[model samples]
Target: MAELPKSVSIREVGPRDGLQNEDPIPTEAKVRLLDALSRTGVRRIEAVSFVHPRAIPQMADADEVWQRAAKVDGVRYSALVPNSKGAQRALAAGFTEIEVVVSASDTHNRRNVNRGTDESLDDIAELIDLLHQAGATAEVIIATSFGCPYEGDVDPARVAAIVDRAVRDGADRVAFGDTTGMGTPRRVRGLITAVRDRDADIPVLLHFHNTRGTALANLLTALELGVTEFDASVGGLGGCPYAPGASGNLATEEAVHMLHDMGIDTDIDLDALIEVAELAEELTGRRLPSGVLRAGPRTRLTASSG
Candidate 1:
């Protein structure tokens, strides 16, 4: 292993992405979980989503969650918005950072948003313009940047093109999602290099699903590519409904532990992150997919070596 980089940013998405996949947990419980995550030293948190309740019933109470969770100082809280209406509600709720997702795979795009690739791009551009007019930061989440389950193999060229379109639309940043957890280390490295080769100076983030047990390996590939921003769930509690057999998002505790072990300064307190991971499990009444959350980290011991 080499010397690790310091000062990486971990964006906590447990409240929005983590909970949206599960059966409805009360909004109060969601707020409490977000509140707990705020103190764990995460610089940013996706506290809520402003989508229609009909689309995602779990996130129907976005207003209440934002109202309660926004009070935490020193943390930049964001909301996921699907369109102009979603952006409108998010701004009205006093959120400054908003994220909109568009799929790179055409099949997944039509399935998720009922629109073709170009149509969704146009919609996202409009939402970006809306966010800009309202003095908010707009980010693009290019879901299924890896291989899509519905459409077997996703071309790196397609992923690069989607990123280019988003960058042209005035997005502040772009995060590529491994929605199905089907990405390998080679794919991760290749796609990242492809994006950079076409569009340099774009701040890119990685969102991973631990399905097929390759999420951590993909993270390592991104780290080698100098990607410091990542989206993670506290206890690895969210999976893609569109991708069958997909696991939850990469675990926050596992990422923190990996970073700390590599001497990377994530600004996250490991014990505090673990505590929040437990809360996520308790709140959802489901098991988290994080290894560190269960077996614990391999840390330096007080026992003397013989």
Candidate 2:
């Protein structure tokens, strides 16, 4: 086993990524969900995505959700933006940490954002200037960085090149997304090395979906390389909009479970977070894929009452 880092920072993507793939929930309920997650000690939350309502009806109330979430103390709220208009909405919503997403594969990019990779980069450049001018940082999430369900077997070099372009366009950080759980431990280690080899200044984060049952293992590989930040959704609530049948993001509860078991502290309350996941299941009215939620954490035991 590789020597791992002492702690990892988890950025909750439940409200945005999680809800985006599901049927739209009431705006007030979304706010309540954020409020509950905030109290669970998740320091960074992707509160909302400022996308076109036509594009993602789940986030139609981005304005109201942002307005309500901006009031939380000591928690950093981020909004995912796709273009100049989304950035404007995020800025107006008072999100200090904004994330923009673009797929690494040309096919996925075109299908996802309706633009080629070049056009998406240009939009991100303009959006970064806008975000930075407002004293906020822009984080570019490179979607399908590992592999795409439609495109299949994305090149590591290609993923690195995308991150390089985003950095050149002034992204504060870049997150590699395993949209279809197509990443292996070797791939995880390779890409992390490749990106830092290109530019040591830009920090990297991982957004993983547990589609192929490899998300947890991949995360352990990243931990060995000193990756300290990640993206996970409560109740494992998310899926690739492009990868139609792929599973959702890695469960926040499961991530914390494995991390804590490995003696790496995440400072997250797993029980409390599981409760948050329960609320998510209730809100979405769907059964979640979270293992810890179904089996319960190891710390909890049933008493013998014979």
Candidate 3:
């Protein structure tokens, strides 16, 4: 059996990816979520995105939201962008760590950015150079890394090629997005192996969705493979807008609960996180899909009727 990591870093995406799919909430609500998440001991959060208002109206007020949200000390925040213009917006908003995305599947890539994957990568190379010049670190997130809803069964070599190119283009880090929750242990292992064969030391983050109930299992497989960073959303919020049947992301509290039970350190307060998840549910006015949030943690004891 492969060894599991002693600790893991969970980046909260509730403020950005989580809300991007929901109806546009008030900017105050967005700021409130950002502030609450920062207090949950999660060191990293994807605070917002810099996309055109017409593209994702939910993220239209990215600037005002980030400006009003209280930036806690010791917490590193990141923003997602779609293109050079979006990157400029994030930089202007003072985000040092920014993320851009491309899909491994050409069909999905076109659906996502309205352009081919190669074209987006070409732009990403220039975007990375621009970010570097501004003393910012660029992280390239490759969506549909496992399987595409339209094409199905993406080749591991294709994903590997994207990783190689992104790293070569000076991306400070890379993440594989399991868009539509199509990842399995076999797929995860194959993809990670292919990427590792080329570059053994580049930092990689995994983003999994719980649409098919395989998110946690996939996470365990990744842990066994020595991946320590992951992206999760509070209250299991958000999914890919263009990918049909894609559900919310893996719940942050659920992942943290499992890690803590296994004696793995995440440095997050489970109780506090649950509280914030409740807040998220209240803000969204809908029931989220987080099992831990619904059923509580495993350690909770009920009064016996004996």
Candidate 1 Cα errors over 4 Å, as ranges: 1-4, 240-246, 300-306
lDDT of 1: 0.87
lDDT of 2 by residue, 1-306 (tens): 668899889999999899988878998889888989998888889888988898789999989886776356777888898888888888887778999888888888998768888888888898899999999999999988888877888888888888888888899999998877888888898888888888778988998888878899899889988899999999998765656656678999999999998888877788899999999999989888899999999988899896
Candidate 2, pairs of clashing residues:
238-248
Cα lDDT tens digits for candidate 1, 1-306: 534457589999988998998779998898889889999989999988988999899999889877776466789999999888888999999888999998889998999889998899999998999899999999999988988888887999999998889999999999999888878999998899999999998899899888888888888888888888999998887866756445678898898898888778888889988988888889888877789888777873556887
Q: Which pairs clash in the backbone of model 3? A: none
How many steric overlaps are in each model, in order? 0, 1, 0
For lDDT, the strongest prediction is 3
Minimum summed lDDT over a 10-residue window in model 3 is located at 239-248
lDDT of 3 by residue, 87-176 (tens): 989999999999999999999989877899999999999999999999999999999999998999999999889988999999999999
Q: What's the lDDT of the predicted structure labeled candidate 2?
A: 0.87
TM-scores for every candidate against the unseen true structure: 0.95, 0.96, 0.97
